[model samples]
Target: MGSVLAFFVLATVFFYNAGNWLVVSHLPQRADAIVVLMGGVPERIPEAVDLYKSGFAPRLIFPDDYEENPPEVLPDGSLLHNDAAKAMHLSSHFNIPDSVIVIVKGPALNTQVEAEIMAIYLADHPETDTIILVSSSYHMRRALIIFRNEFASKGLEITIISVPSRYTAFDPEKWWQTAGDRKTVFLEYIKIAYNLLWDRWF
Candidate 1:
């Protein structure tokens, strides 16, 4: 009983730390650029596009490791490109213009892996500073930890913000409804613990 209760307490803490607290309190209001971490719910597109349309950042960087093929095919059997990629592609349809979004395909891994690539890209560019590190609110704490540890060592002054993953808000009670959701929260909790332990020792 004690172990079970302890588990619940710990789970709640992780959700609270990584959830809306990061988005509402920690997100940077302005930045030199916006780096939207790919792989969130499809709802984030409008938020990213809106940021661009509103001139929050003249450019948007989406770090991906997209293959040559899209994730699926259209209803008529024609190839539908990667939804995230195509959404950015369709931005011109919304009048945001083709010049605003830059898709950077890094490698297959977690956001830390992708952010490392973004950090390197910023390093090479030299002209760019500040970036909104966009991802689902649940992932923001881990993302920012990885970005700050990795990017700062490279001598780049970047600002990260949690642009809430589209159509989703932070709620711990909602996690237990699905097995996938529960597993994700569990894995994230482990990752958070690993990060905390590693930060203290190394």
Candidate 2:
């Protein structure tokens, strides 16, 4: 009985904290650029576009690995990668001009690689001192940590703004009720732990 009670108590604490950690909303009033990290659902792009339209940033950057893959043929015969397709959709849907959208093409397979690519871009664009990073709510914490660690030596400011994902089954109010949410939250915790250790030791 005591073991069961202890388990329940520990789980309660974990669930509460997990929901809180999933959504880290530290948005700055203004930034030099708005960076939308690719990987999650299509919700991220729209959110970034909204931020851009709201005048949060003058430039929007998307770092994706689509350049390394074959171009996806569209119905209109125009060839575009998944990343470019999304960017184009945002451009047309939001009436954003093509010149304002900057696509940093590279082999960025994960968050770490994306951060590296972004670091290189920041190096080139010395005027961009502050950047707003937009990603899924559940991914914001890990993304922020990785970006902070990656840019620690670069003197760049990163502010995270999380957008709720339509595809991910992360329900902050009742995260433990569904199996998908449980699994995602569990995996996120593991990744967070791994990243923390890796950043510390290596």
Candidate 3:
């Protein structure tokens, strides 16, 4: 009974932090740019647009190596996924315009590589300070670790804005039992628990 009670107490703390990390929020009152992680889905693109509209960042940079799954299959050319395309679509819808939106396509195969590449871009253009990292709820914890590591030495003052939402996998409402939700939660549990206990991430 004691062990079970302890477990629940720990679980409550973990979920509270996770909930905070999942939702994207305003930065430290002075922000210059917003960068979105590219696993484009129903969640990220819209979140970025919403941030832009909210005046969180002056510019929105979508840095990615590959276009996600394109809406229509490509014949001989690489194309953008619905998520990526949605960024474009939302930009137009929100009247963000082309100037404030920077879409950098390199070889960002994963989060680490993407961070490295984004760091390089920001290095050259160092004027933009104070950033908001937009990502899914489950991804925020792990993603922030990578983002911090990659950007640590770069000298950019940044704040993370985790956008928690039920995206692309479907049935946003019934996440507790869904396979995707379960998988995400399991991963998140491992990530947060491990990090809290072990102080992982170098």
How many residue pairs clash (N, CA or C atoms closer than 3 angstroms) in each of the candidate models, in the order given?
A: 0, 0, 3
Rank list by lDDT: 2, 1, 3
Q: Per-prediction TM-score, please?
A: 0.74, 0.83, 0.69
Full-model lDDT, candidate 3? 0.64
Q: Candidate 1, residue 32: CA error in Å?
A: 1.9
Give a tens-digit lDDT track for model 3, residues 83-175.
Answer: 445566556766778888887666677777777888888777778656777776566667777777667767765555544433534332344
lDDT of 1 by residue, 1-202 (tens): 9999999999988765543333432544667777777665355666677677777777877776555453566566755345446556556556766676777756636666786788778888877777766666567677777788878777788666656555544464567666776676777768878876876788
lDDT of 1 at 69: 51
Output the lDDT of residue 115, model 3: 76
Q: What C-alpha RMSD separates each model from the true structure?
A: 4.3, 3.0, 4.7
lDDT of model number 2:
0.75
As for model 2, its CA RMSD to the true structure in angstroms is 3.0
lDDT for model 1: 0.67
Where does candidate 3 stray beyond 4 Å? Answer: 1-30, 67-86, 153-175, 189-202
Candidate 2: count of backbone clashes, pairs at least 3 residues apart or interchain: 0
Error of 2 at 141 (Å): 0.1
